[model samples]
Target: MAAPLSLRAPAATPRLPRLAGTIRQPLLGAVAVALFLLSWWGATASGMVARLFLPSPVEVAQATWRLLGSGQLVAAILASSARVFAGFAIAALIAVPLGIAMAVCGPVRAVLTPFISLLRPLPSITWIPLTILWLGIGETQKVAIVILGCWIYILLATHEATRRVDPLLVRAARNLGAGDLTVMREVILPAALPGILAGLKVTLAIAWSCVLSAEMVAAHNGLGAMIWEGKDWGDMTQVLVGMVAISLTVLLADLVATRLERALLPWERHRRH
Candidate 1:
């Protein structure tokens, strides 16, 4: 017979190189930003839109520099950032433990679930008037707004994360003579950490937005207040500068959280790779 066809598996196709997880991805992101700037510059240069409505990127940059030189940008950033972190920290301290308790205790869940459900859908802005009335237009009110905006979401996320812990793992720990607290401390908490961290990252963003809203309405200084002032004066450049500052701050916060998540859950990172 024709020397019998060689019995062998087909050769696998060579995989194409991917840009993902490579330096090229960041380079490509830079390229995209450059293109956007170019287009924006072109639009402004060509007079496609009124400069009054949309200031050029250079104008926005110069405005940012002016604010920085005057120390206004720095102060606003510090004020807003402080409010965000303060509220977020307070929420985390309460919500995380409460969430864990709800997961582990039936009575706790029964007591909190209805209230969470009732209040979770309310937007942070809805609380502004009430907060001003109750807490006065002060830092306390701003921080409380952030807390009200973030805590329920954090609690819900923690609850879901706790619930998702595999029952088998808990059982195995218990069978090894672990008490409920031991099981929770050693097994459940680690398992739920990733989800909890992700939730915190999201809640941080929400906190920022809430603080901005609070500042816009009540505060004398903050990026949000800067934007509001700019709007009142019809200074598009100042408004754009505030917008950029907020965007950059949020981006940096997200990056920090992402790095922390990777550090805490190296196994998850490796598994994905």
Candidate 2:
């Protein structure tokens, strides 16, 4: 007798390997950090590298504590953080609008593209001498360097994001009797926001790096200045402490950016899931 189709057993399906647990992510990160510290300690303890060349983690901790007690570390952090915030904020304000304009207007793009192409290839460090020449060794010079370093990247990212926005959504908004401004504000901006936010996060890191280069040239108080002072005095521990502070600050900033991105782009998160 022929088996009824409804009662027939289904063909065996292929089973994929189970994905790793979410908890494994944080566990692995912790394990990696612990291993790195252990290796560093082992190297220093075993004298694989001289203490002068590579200070022990314990020595760096001690130096950090000493700096904190003296309030120098806190002050340096504040100064550098302020510069990064100021520069990044200003760049975003200018770049965001200009980038959108460039994406929408051919004339604007034609005018700016050449200059951007020429300058974008140059590293932030290359601007130090020119900035010093133009703005002198003042806070303005440092801020200018950061602006130059970050604004181009922010502009490019925003332009690409704006251009990549789905045209169908724009057309639908227009067909629904939305004006150009309405379409832009309601449809375009929101659509491009995820990319814009991602670009800003990258620009923030570039701003930090530029600030360090600026401070290296001429600055009285900043993490970069602290590092330079340490180098001058051959204090590897102090340099290590400054480096650690920079790394921690950048990590904290990135964490905040991630939270902000998730909050601002809930749709993106939902889509990803």
Q: What TM-score goes with each of the models?
A: 0.91, 0.90
The lowest-lDDT stretch of 10 consecutive residues in candidate 1 is: 14-23
lDDT of 2: 0.91
Residue 241 alpha-carbon offset, candidate 2, angstroms:
0.8
lDDT of 1 by residue, 143-227 (tens): 9999999999899999999989999999999999999889988999999999899899999999999999999999999999999
lDDT of each: 0.93, 0.91
143 in model 1: Cα distance from truth in Å? 0.4
Candidate 2 TM-score over all chains jointly: 0.90
Runs of candidate 1 exceeding 4 Å displacement: 1-21
Residues 1-273 of candidate 2: C-alpha lDDT, one tens digit per residue: 997679768986644322345567778999999999989989999999788799888888889999999999999999999989899999999999999999888999999999998999998899998888898988888888888889999999999999999999999999999998999999999999998998999889999999998898799999999999999999989888899899999999999999989999888886764
Which stretches of candidate 2 lie above 4 Å from their native place? 1-20
Residue 188: error of model 2 in Å?
0.7
